[model samples]
Each structure stands twice: as structure tokens, then as C-alpha cells.
Target: MYLWIITGVVLIVSFIFNKDKTIQGLKKAWKQLYGIGSLLVLVLICVAIALNFINEDLITQTLSGGNRYIGFLSAVVIGSIAMMPGFIAFPLAGILRQNNVPFMVVSAFTTTLMMVGILTFPFEKKYLGFKVALIRNFICFTICIVVALVTGLIYREIF
Candidate 1:
């Protein structure tokens, strides 16, 4: 709320100072937003559908129960596949923690959710080329696991 207020005030000030530039900037911003809007909506819808099938109990059982490695692997796979915005992912992480899901699993999910983009691979590939996109995704996936393990260690969720 505060951020929005601040942004609105800043935008108003910019408009006052240079109406033409402000209008031009806003037009470009809108174009970019419009370009990505459909894809963003599609991604959010996919995440919503996925969430409908996943309950808090299932998350706790799969992520915090026996076989930590397997649980971590499951989180990596699911998170890598599901591409959601950070705004949604962070709150979801909180919910997972509230459900008693271990920090390691939550980290794995959130890290991979932010880093890996399996669902957006084609879009990335189009701009970055197939090889670069694939390599980036692979590195991000590895880093997310490392980050999750480090977080687990810090939180003493792992011995």
C-alpha cells in the first residue's frame, strides 16, 4: 500500500515535470506489460490448477516426512515445472512453513520456483537461444538445490 502510494506520487511528479516523457515512458511500460500479460495469466492459471490438487497435509507429508532426499527431489521437480510469480510463491512458502513443512523443503520449492522456469523454457529459448536457456535452467536448478541445503543447514533442519 505504501509502495503504491509512493509510486503514484512519483508518477505524478514525473508527469508534472515532463508530461511528454512521462507519457512516453508509461506507453512503453504498458506495451511491455501487455506483451507479457497473457503469458503471465496463463502461468498463474496453471499454478492455481496445480494448487487445487495439492493440500497442506500432502505438502507436509511429502516435504517434511521420511526420506528427506526424496522429499527434496520431489520439491525440485515440482517447483522447476511450476512457474509462478514471486508474489505468489513467497506467501505459499509461508503457508508451507505454517503447515510444519521443513525449511529445507520450503527453500527447495521457493528457490526452484523463482530460479527454474521449465514452463517458460520455449519463451526463454526463443530469445536466449536453445542452448543458453537450457544451460541457464540447469545451473539454476543445481543452485536452487544447493541453496536449499544451505538454508536447511542454517536452520538445523539437516544434520
Candidate 2:
């Protein structure tokens, strides 16, 4: 609601200054949206299916969710390997936590989901050779573990 209102105000202001430029900008934005609409739809569908099919209780029961180290490691592996957009991934992490999953596990999952990109390795490799891509992802994965551990420990202590 606020976004629409703010966007309306911006569009009105832009049109007042220069209608043609504003129109052209809107057209470009629309074109870009159209291009990614299909990809967005597919990603959302996959996310929904994954969340529904993968039982939260099973993960909690099997992955030693009560054991911080095991949960952390499991989170790191799952998050690193899963190919999810940040927009969707964060919400999923929250859902896991709400389902009584451990804080450390959710933290690790969220951290690696943002920092490491196992699925995007091909794209990264195309830009920066395979070696660099491999190294970068490895380093990022390690750093994510550290960050998640610290965040989880502090969060657990405070709350």
C-alpha cells in the first residue's frame, strides 16, 4: 500500500517535470518486468513445491536440530546447495524457525542462502573463470558459517 502510494507520488512528480521521459522510463521498466515475469513465476512455483513436499518435522527429527553443531552444518549444506532467490529464501528461513527449528540452524541457512551460490556457480564461472568461482564460493561459505554462528550464539543469549 505504501509502495503504491509512493510510486504514484513519484510518477506524478516526474510527469509534472517531463512527461515524455517519465513515459519512456515506465515503458523500459515494463519491458524489464515482462522479460523476468516468467522466470519469477517458475521460481515461485518451485519454492512452493519445495516447501510443501519437504516436511519440517522430518528435518527437525533427523538432522539433530537440538544439537547446535549438527543443525548448523545441516543448515549450511542445505542453504548452499538450494537455488533460491533472496526474496523467497529469507521468508522460508523464518518459516523454519517458526516451526520450532533451531535458531542456529535458521541463521546458518539464512546466511549461506545470501552469501553462497552453488547454483549460480555456472554464471559466476562464465564471468570469472572456474577456479576463481570455486574459491570465492568456498570462502563465502566459510564466512557465512562464522557469521551465522556468531549471530545465533548472541541471539540465543539475548532472547
Best by lDDT: 1
* Residue range 17-120, candidate 1, lDDT tens digits: 99999999999999988877877777677667876766445555677666777888888887887766677778877877776777898889888978998877
Taking all chains together, the TM-score of candidate 1 against the true structure is: 0.70
Indicate the residue-level lDDT of 104 in model 2.
68
Per-candidate count of clashing residue pairs (backbone under 3 Å): 0, 0
TM-scores of the candidates are: 0.70, 0.62
Q: What global local distance difference test value does model 2 have?
A: 0.73
Q: For residue 32, what is the lDDT in candidate 1?
A: 83
lDDT of 2 at 49: 68
Which residue pairs show backbone clashes in model 2? none
Per-prediction RMSD in angstroms?
Answer: 3.7, 5.4
Predicted structure 1: lDDT: 0.81
Cα shift from native, residue 113, model 2 (Å): 4.0
